[model samples]
Target: MNPFVDIILRSCTVYFFMVLALRVFGKRELSQLNSADIVLILLISNSVQNAMVGSNTSLEGGILAALALFVINYLFKRWINQSKTVKDWVLSKPQVLIHNGNVEFKTLAKLGITSEELDEAIREHGVESHKNVKLAMFEIDGNISIISGDNNLKQTHHKRKIHKTLNEL
Candidate 1:
């Protein structure tokens, strides 16, 4: 085998194994990541290094592995976009943790989120209390979205006040 071709083949094999491992492990939201998740990601790179370079430790091997990874990621993105079911399977739907100012304890528990964690999330959003919130969603991407009950009322009042001021002017 030509030296360059051998490098390419090895790189491709490493890329394939990495992608397969990632798919099998499933998706995890950034905010939802624990210590174990971080360790697994770190280990993946270390484990694949030998397979990618092997006895052919060269700059070209590293470049080829990076290129193969990019190509695989691009194809995966396109596949997810082309099918809604695939998208759902790859990226889960957002879970509603709070609705009508009531905490969905069951949902939160299922997500492995504790009450303290929920409170911290809400506090990070600058919300004083759950009652002040209309809807609080835990997005699939692991971010919290808090929709305040007062926001609608404030908007309505602001519009009315603007109209009154315009009339007076």
Candidate 2:
């Protein structure tokens, strides 16, 4: 096989594997980037670089690999947008964590979210307590979206860049 073609194939394989891995790992991994998460991402990228380009470390080879990844990514996004079945298969539906001031404990447990984390997210949204929340959703993109039943009907998306312990907050 031509080296450029090989590079393209390898890059495409890595891209799909990454998408599958992220889907299997849960979308929460997308929202928060703790120290360990950053480290893992960095290491994974480094480890996959060789697999993508193989022994051909020339600039053209590297660019071809990146071009392949970009093309596949664009195609994937287009396909997902065009096909409901593909979108559903690739992404999870948002989960309701709180409704009408009631905490959805089962949903929290299923999503591996702790009470403290929920409380933190609520506080982040400026809601004094979960009782004031009209609806809290665990979004498919790994964001905790809070809608308050307060007079203003405020809504907030809790997209945390880094995980913080309760004590640290």
Candidate 3:
């Protein structure tokens, strides 16, 4: 196979594998990156770097691989944007973690989110308690979204987790 063709094939393979891996791993990971998560991601990228570009250390080869990855990603996201069914298939549906001031224990458990984590998120928003929150959703992106009693939304400015150290614990 041509080296350029090989680069294309390898990059595409890595990109698709990562998408499938993320889906199987669940949305909790994509929403917040704990220290362990960060380490895992960094390692995965390092491991895949050579796999995507192969032994072609040339600038052209690197640029081709990068271009192929970006193009594939853009096209996939565009396709998802065009079709809700595709979007649903590719991404997790938002889940309700709390409703009417009641914590959805089952949901929290199913999502691998601890009650302590949920409680901390609620308090972080100044809602006082779960009872004061009209609704809380574990969004498809991995952040817990809160709607309080006064029709105000207390949401994290950044989706990335900053202070939490025991996310998986």
Candidate 4:
């Protein structure tokens, strides 16, 4: 087997494994990164580096591995866009956390989100309380989306604020 081809295969395998692990373990923790999450990311990257490069310590090997990972990710995205079934299997549906000022406790619990987190997201959007929130959705990308309004007033107040610059939710 060619060294570059081996690097490409190894990188692709690692990428798929990481994606599957995150998909199965729940993506909630990824929304809000704490100290532990950062540490976990650092450690995982360091550990996976060896698995991707194997015995090839050359700069070319490292570049090939990285390029392979990028290409695999690009292809995966394209596949998801082209296939509805693939998209559905690879991604979860957006969850409705609050509707008509009513918090869906079951959905929140299922998503491993606390009432406090929901409330915080609402407040971040400038909603005074749950009653002010017309709709609150936990998006598939892992961000809380809140739309505030008063039915009596016949108004809509939808606001979104990014907690951090994230590559993905």
TM-score of each model, in listed order = 0.73, 0.89, 0.85, 0.83
In the predicted model 1, the residue pairs found to clash are none
116-135, model 4: which lDDT tens digit per residue?
66776776676789987878
Per-residue lDDT value at 161 in model 1: 11
Would you give me the overall lDDT of model 3?
Answer: 0.82
Candidate 3: residue 126 lDDT (0-100): 70
* Error in Å for residue 47 of model 4: 1.3
lDDT of 4: 0.80
The number of the candidate with the highest TM-score is 2
Candidate 1 weakest lDDT stretch, 10 residues: 154-163
Better of 3 and 4 by TM-score: 3
Model 2 per-residue lDDT tens digits across residues 1-169: 9999999999999999999998888554556666667798899999999999999999999989989999999999999999999999998899999999999999999988889889989998889999999899988777899988777645667874545554376
lDDT of 3 by residue, 1-169 (tens): 9999999999999999998888787544555766778798899999999999989999999999999999999999999999999898888888898899999899888978777778878877777889988888987777777788875554552253645455444
Q: Encode model 1's per-residue lDDT on 58-161: one tens digit a residue.
A: 78777776776677678778988999988866677888888988999999887676676667666666677887777878776666677776653331100001
Give per-residue lDDT, candidate 1, residue 101: 89
Pairs of residues clashing in candidate 3 = none
- Give the TM-score comparing model 3 with the true structure, all chains together: 0.85
Candidate 1 lDDT: 0.68
**lDDT of every predicted structure (CA atoms):** 0.68, 0.87, 0.82, 0.80
